[model samples]
Target: MRFLRQSMIGVFLAAVSLGLLVYAAYVVQSAVQARLSDDAPAPPPRERVFAVHLERAEARTITPVMETFGEISSRRTLELRAAVAGRVTALHENFEDAGRVTQGEVLVRIDPSEMQAAVDRLSADLADAEAEIRDARRARDLAGAEQTAAEHQVSLREKAYNRQLDLAGRGVGSTAAVETAELQAAAARATVLARRQDVARAEARVDQAATRLLRQRIALTEARRTLADTAIEAPFSGTLSDTSVVEGRLVSANERLADLIDPNDLEVSFQVSTAQYARLLNPEGGLIDTRVLARLDVAGVDAQATGSLSRVSAGAGDGQTGRRVFARLTHASGFRPGDFVTLEIEEQPLPDVISLPASALGSDSTVLVNGEDNRLEVLAVTLLRRQGDQVLVRGEGLEGRDVVTTRTPLLGPGVSIRVLRQEAVVSAGVPDMLELSEERRARLVAFVKGTEHMPAETKERVLAQLAEREVPAQMVARIESRMGG
Candidate 1:
């Protein structure tokens, strides 16, 4: 009975200890939940402010420019062709591609031996004809002299017949003598008529010789002309291209030898949309002489020229949507045919217009302008022209106000903005020179040297820059951009 009572006491003590532990765990859980619910903070409100680039709108007269790509061409181009079939005997010292030639300069010489021989033969024939003409003239003179002698004999016979008739009439001569005198006069007259016919025949022979002489002279002149054609002379001062003829090369008549292009007389041919084409014309429906600047970027080198709008194509080309236009280049010294160039044509100036970055203009010609209290205001603008990265716009209440240069979807009317000033605009100064490594400098130098299409002057300038210890940052960036770096 004592052992059973001790067991009961131990069990009761174990149960009480278990209940106390469970109650302490429940109180700790409640205290932790209450602390959490009391310490958690509320969520903050969302901010509507956005950071953007901004530029002040200044209204002024802006001249819009239309940019287009074009190919350089020569207004005067000639195909040098052979006029006679012969072997090329001689070539000028500068008779090669890109060779400079003056007007009337003999560019190539064909074998003139054959043509010379023909000319000599024709000349000999002409001489022979001339000699024959002289001989015929002498013969004609001799025939005339014989006719004169025969006429004298006829006159003498007639006088004798008259005398015989008178003697017979006076009874101092016999009738037979008078009749014989009359017969003699008749025979003399027949001899005179034969001499006259001989003179006529001789004259006809002389005329025939003269005609033959004329024909022979004509033949000689033609042969001489052909001989002259053997020496191909430059029609005008130009540069030679597409040269195919060389010394000892046999060529046929009318074979193309080379192409001659007047480098000074160069033009740019480009195509523009119908609307742009219409804007390039004057009120008279003719192409306006708008000033144009053409630029060719060759291997990071820029070659520029100035010109004026010349004409428009007479007919639209097949598979082309726009009108073709041509500009007459005034100074095209470094330009060549087939060079693709960019042209910036000056259009009519717009009055009271604001020029801004293209990114500033939004859909439906709306722009975001910073309004009162630095809030964004959607302002409608009239987009006059889009030139490169800039747009010319005219709108009321835009002047003397700061307009956001860059737009984003998050930005809207009445939204607050934090202006991020652009260093490129705030400074508006020359770009700083950049320090380059030896490898980069060498690479640029090699690139400039390898650019065969670049103009010599531009290449030299670029090389000079590369030789310097530091190059302009902007220039380096431009070069790298062209190099696709």
Candidate 2:
């Protein structure tokens, strides 16, 4: 009976402990549920105080271009060399380093004494030659008179010989007398023949004298030309470069004195990778004439020059990865040869694509589509080209779609991004200062607001960019002024 009572007490105690444990578990469950209900995300704090930077879509023509590098060079590069050996007597006042000059301007004058002396000697010889010509004419006239007299004498002797022969044959006179008459006629004929020979000799002498005079005249003319070369004249209007010649400097014939360059005909030379060159080649396999731009880093002097592709080297250079190209600059002010510069040449424009900031495109081709949580969306885009500070993307929905103008490099696919100052970013992002359109404006605004969470300040900047984006006809006119039909 005592053992049964102890067992009952132990069983009662265990049942009470189990009931206490169940009650404690129910209380902890109630506390956890209340805590979860209290923490339910706080209702996504709405930052309507600061306006998000937004912009509308725009309808404007955008030129798709390719960019390349190049160097400045002058088209007219002349090596001023001495045409004749002489001491440089004078250099023009404009013959200084980088000095401008005019065509036909005498840049240098050699000591013309020797050339002048040669001219004088030639002139004297030419005069002597002329006098000899006159003498030759006089001699020719005398020979003509002698020749006429010899002809008449020969005629008379022939008649006399005929008479003597007849008399001897008829026996009308003594044989000795006829023989003597014949001998007399023969002697007369001999005399005429000797006189004719003298006349022929005189004619030949006249011709010799005339030929000598002609040769002398030619020598004189050559001397005169040499004398003129003593003074060096500028071939064209240009600037003088590498001018190391000084007055009184001895310059030998064919010696390099200096160089002349025409800045008006300036060119930009550059090298392009083989792939780039191939892209620029036309269908005929020749280099295409592409538009080019040059940027100079002069303080307050961001001047730009226009150019066209001239040619590319036929063969690749040794160990060079790209082909060499030359472009002719239309307006080349403040440009000089050997000036280290970077050129952004406009290559062929790609079609069926739109341009946007790299930041806007998310990783794996994802992009922010709509409403605040940065609705991550994917775009079926064909990446065409990448220019400095710009990218050309093409796709079915890309043309009319508003893309993020600028973004941080860290932006990736599915990553959240708050669009700030969309319109302002686009205008400020490129070399050109232009505004956005209504369509692009709305697109930009929607893109910015769609961010899951955006800072108030960022939203305001984005909105301000949208406001700046104006599809003003005035701005269009300004852009048109730079282009032509």
Candidate 3:
């Protein structure tokens, strides 16, 4: 009976323990499901991050670069116009289409037969006039001789009349003799008057002949000049750009023969805004005579020419407010007028600026800078200028700091970045110990500063930094000076 009671008691205890164990398992399962439901929903899919290369902004002496587009034109241009109406007879060796020519060089000869004939006719007329003048002179000389002879006859007749009078008075002369002497004297006087009239008439004829000869001589000169005009000549040295006439072809008076361009007198014409003009036009601006260099690219020809600044328009063009300027070329060969060309001009430069590839700049005129927390931070940069593929920028904290050079569309503000960068020393005496981790560099820089008053600490930092890589003595001194001892 005692053994039976013990067995029963053991069975009861086993059942109780089995029941408690089942309850505890149910409770534990319920708690686990509740805990999982309450846990913060799995953090949203993490944003994608990109690795990039970084470079430190550099201190540079950047030149002010000006970029413009303009047209090429010749300073010396000429239009070949005919001087008179004539048929084209002969063309000079250099008178072909687009031929080259020099000043005072004949280009073509017109049909000068007509002009030559006119010249000959005028010459003959002048000869006739001169012969008439000579005859009039001879006639006048004969008239004068006759007048002198008539005067001598009159004197002789007077002497005879006086002698006849004395004879009559002495009663030895007859009345008939005295009367005859008087009559003779009177006839002689009348003859002298007639001779004088002839002389006057001859003088008048000579004068008239001289006037006619002078007029004929003038006509001869005009005819010769007209003949000379038959031969065409180049006004200045240049290449014949467009020629419309050919040898053995006839041309009209005042007709355009060709267009000439002086390659040696090439110039580049360009327009600029009013603000830009102010800088270039200031009397003290010093850009008036500044040398302007130009480059020309000829179409369909593998040739180029360089030029210099020659002149600026005195005033803006009518209805065009901008200033126009020109540059003279030294090597104008192989260049034609009215060609378009690109240009680069220099302007005033800003000091202490940084230049980088324009691609790195963002739309808002900002650039990505590596931040303190190893993240990207957008910083606003002031743009000084933009050239072809290059830009000059100025920012508050970009100096001596690493910046992302290339545009990274995937990288945004507050995003973490793993910059894979190489150590490159900046040229302008800026220390490039940036190879060290940001934290490590800051700590080392601080340590170097703290050692200024403590000779032992100074030596320690100097030796440690020197062991890794060389540090500039100037930087060490600067740190020591900044130490708040």
Candidate 4:
């Protein structure tokens, strides 16, 4: 009975398995038919719109400034040298390095005893020559008078000879008497010739004496000049530098004594690319005398001065490209020669030009402008000048148009755009201010005070600014950058 029951259970199990397989086959066939017969449409992709910052393109006269690195220098720097070799006898109270002096102030006095003695001896020689000239003139006069008397006697002798000849011709005079008169006339003629020779010698002596006197006068003038050279006077009011002379120091002719730097006559020299140089020229092709400003950074302190473009270097330096430019400072307080500085040169006013952020310019010399329906349109523009973070450009149909402040690869012509932010055109002026922590302020103050090259007034001003509640952000950045903090 157990074996029969087990057989019945196995047969039931087999039937159930066959029925499950048949159901699975029917479901797979139905799924295949549905997938082959299905018809569905895909949804179209939506166009992408980019949001960017925009600024209005306004046409206005904007002066572009070219900023470059430079060096501060004095245009009226002079090298003080010893004109004559001698021992320095005395020195000015301020004859030292960094000493202030005035024009015509004697700075050095070389030993003048030798020069003075030379002058005295030349003067005496000149006086002796003058006296000799006077004596020669008197002698010439006496010789002339003697020559005249001799000529008179000759005339008398000739008259006597003529009378004797007349007597002889009448046969009333002896031959010996006529011969004697003839001999006397010949001797008187010889005396006249001798007197004429004396007069010539006297004239020659007078000429020699006059020449000697002229030579002596020239020598005296030279000696006086030498004596004057013993006292070295300042040519202009300025400060002394590189002083190498002192009292009792022996110096040679043309030896450098010091450097006279006209602190008031300050200038700055800088360089610019050829393209930039071309734009700084006037319509006549000459460099325009544009306004400039020089700034020197000493630690955290800045020394600023106003100036004008003066001249350009004739040649580009060796192994250098572009032009070297110079500017004359008007009030260059706290500036010293050889100090590295920054120069801001203002170019000519550009009319009908729009100033835009430098990022707005595209590599293809084009800019993106907002068109109708908030779409971007590429506009060709002429890039006039680049002023630090800004660019001056001009283009047709760009005025009064909304321009993209920055360009991106995703933005192009006919592309839809949304302005995330709009900014009005702002002029570049003074730097923004920032509040500093106590530690930062103290650090900057310490740096400014410790700067050896910084002027006292400049340091005080800088300290005053640091002491305030807020400081110039630019100044802080510069100071921190130099401090490597």
Candidate 5:
């Protein structure tokens, strides 16, 4: 009975296993049959079309602009220095930092008391020298008269000696008388010689006096110059900066007192890469006088000035790369020295070139142009110049073709694209207008009207635009972006 029961259980287990195998087979067969019976081929893979902004390439001559940062400075800046050391006794009312001064304006006065006293003393000494000179002349004249009298006496004595000798020879005069007359003549001649020596000494004295007078006059002139130097005067009309002197302050000779800057003689110094610098050069290898515009932002307002390229730095400055350039501004009304400014310099114009967004250029110096059937084709281009965010390129068959402004890695040659924005709609110079839905118009108008930071004139203009049948799409977009919608 136990064997029979075991056999029955085994048979039952086998039967259940067989039934499970059959049900699995049936499920697999039904699935296979269903898939095979559908007989529908898989649809061909569709190409993905990327939406991109496109700009039409139009060949024309365009002057590329190179933008750089620069510093504004004065071409004519003078350091105000004290020419003589003294204590500041007087100060001009406007002799301070940022003071406006005109030509020949006295800015400071060092204590002139000492200089004046020196000058007075020198003048007195000069006067004494002149008086001495006059006295020497009178003495010289008296010595000459004395010499003449002595000479006349000598002549009379000689004549008397000759007469006495003649008398002695003729036996009318004694030998003693002749000898005495001869001795008297000799004594008179000696007196004449002494007078001549006195005359020479007087002439020498006169020369000495003249020399002393000249030296004293020079000293007096120098003292007067020193006195003049005590008063500091402006050499030109300009503005003063960095003033350091004050009333009653002691200053040394050649001490820097302030800086005088000619606001009219303004210049901007900027640096550019070697490649860009080459573009600014003419065929003669000298820097061309390219037109430039300098802009300074002051309190949210732009101060613009026009200028021309002046010269290139003789050497690249220490710890810097590229070429340093200078530009002379024509009219710098609201600019000052050492102000940081923006410079836009016009480069040589490139003919038969198209200015495209920088992103349109590929890493391989190739650009993707729109081909037939909305496909993109890679074309080799020559890069002429780079103007800020744009690049100037020239290539064959690149004109009149739409270029993708913004490129992505997913986009490549032979890929399909959907032009999200056309050249006319996205152009910078033209105004893009479109009819807006009433709801959108109302929302934008409400957002613009509610903006407190917006100026009234701008707000009014925006409202007026919205009221028209067609409104500018850029303005609407800007308004919506501000609305956080």
Candidate 6:
């Protein structure tokens, strides 16, 4: 009975311990659930916005420039030709290609032996003709004297015949004597007529001799002219090109010998679309004298010259579109024919136009301007002109507004934007001169000098710049790039 009572006491103790453990577990679970039910710390406040570059739109008059490329050519070019066929015997000291020649300078001489011989022969013929003329005059004078003597004899015979007739009538002379006298008179008359015929023949010979002398003189003149043509003279001062003649070479008449080009009188010939061509004309349908800047980039050196629009081609070339125009360069010292150059032509000034970066414009002629609350607003703009990286636009109510200078896919109308920095808008003007170091200047000068094809004036200009303490940095960079340095 005592053991049974002890076992019940142990069971009661175990049950109490188990019940306490269950109550403690429930209390811990309630605390854990309450901790999780509390609201978590809110995320940091975030706003979405696009960062972009911004520029202001200002109303101003802008002169738009149309850029094109063309080849330089001389305003006057002559193809030197051989006027007479002969073997080349002589050439001037400066008669080679690229040789400079002055007007009236003799450049070549053909073999004059043949021409000289012909002239000499003609001269001899002329002298012979003159001698014949003199001889014919003498003959004519002798004929006149003979005719006079024959007429005197005829008169004497006539008087004798008359005497014989009178004697016959008076019965003192015989009829045979009278008849003889009459026949003698008739014979004398015939002799006078023959003398007259001889005089006429002599006069005809004189005339023939005179005509022959004239013909000989004309032939001699022509021969002398041919002789002079053997020497080819420069018609004007210019540089020689495309020379094919050499000493001992036989050339035919009218064959091209060389080309002479007046490099000073250079004009740039370029073609432009019909629309651009129309803009270049005036109200009277004539091309306006628009200012043009021609630039030739050679080995990173810029040979620039100013010019004016001169004229346009009367008709379009075969298989060619657009009108061909020419610009007469002024002070084109370093320019040459066949030089491909860049031409910048100034157009009429556009008034009250806004200039913006080209990237700011959308393909549909719309731009994103920051409107109220710094939000982007799509604005339609008229693209007046595009100059390099910038565009001239005409938009209503666009002045004094900040326009986004760069476009991105993320940017659109009504999208909030944060301008990183406000850019100062300036006009696109001439490129600034660069400053270079002495070493760079020397290098550029050497390179310019080493270029054999560069014109003298261009070399001089480059050298002058190199002589300065500072050279254009852009020019140096260009030269270095080409030098592969």
What TM-score, over all chains together, does every model reach? 0.73, 0.64, 0.57, 0.86, 0.71, 0.74
Q: What's model 6's lDDT at 330?
A: 89
Candidate with top TM-score is 4
Residues 1-485, candidate 2: write the lDDT tens digits: 89999999999999999999998898999999888879556676753222223333233445556565667888889999998998988989999987999999999999999989999998898888888878877877887787778778777877877787788789875777767767777777787787778778877877888898898889888988999999889999998888888998898899988899887888888888887788887899887777788765331123468878888877778888788988888866656677656677666655445566665555555443334465333456666666665556556544444445433454434555455646534354344445766765566556556653333444555456457745444433432343320
Error of 4 at 96 (Å): 1.7
Across 59-174, the per-residue lDDT of candidate 6 in tens digits comes to 99988899999999998899999989999999988888899999999999999999999999999999999999999999999999999999999999999999999999999999
The number of residue pairs in model 4 that clash at the backbone is 0
Per-residue alpha-carbon lDDT of candidate 3 for residues 335-442, written as tens digits (9 for 90 to 100):
567767767766655689987678778999999889987789888899887877778899988887777778766877887888877455458855555344555456
Instruction: Report the C-alpha lDDT of model 4 over 307-363, residue by residue, as the tens digit.
Output: 988899999999999999888898787888888888888888889999888999999
Per-prediction count of colliding residue pairs? 0, 35, 0, 0, 0, 1
Candidate 3 or 2, higher lDDT: 3
The residue-by-residue lDDT of candidate 1 on 449-483, one tens digit each, is 87777777788888888788878887787777767
What residue runs in model 5 are displaced by over 4 Å at the alpha carbon?
Answer: 1-40, 45-54, 85-87, 141-196, 249-256, 371-375, 400-402, 416-421, 424-485
> Residue 178, candidate 6: how far off, in angstroms?
17
lDDT of 5 by residue, 142-247 (tens): 9999999999999999999999999998999999999999999999999999999999999999999999999999999999999999989999999899999889
lDDT of 6: 0.90
Q: Which RMSD does model 3 reach against the true structure?
A: 19.0
* Candidates by lDDT, descending order: 4, 6, 1, 5, 3, 2
The C-alpha stretches of model 3 lying farther than 4 A from their native spots are 1-36, 40-61, 102-104, 127-217, 282-287, 291-303, 314-321, 348-352, 359-382, 393-485
Considering only N, C-alpha and C atoms within 3 Å, which residue pairs clash in candidate 6?
A: 434-473
Better of 4 and 5 by lDDT: 4
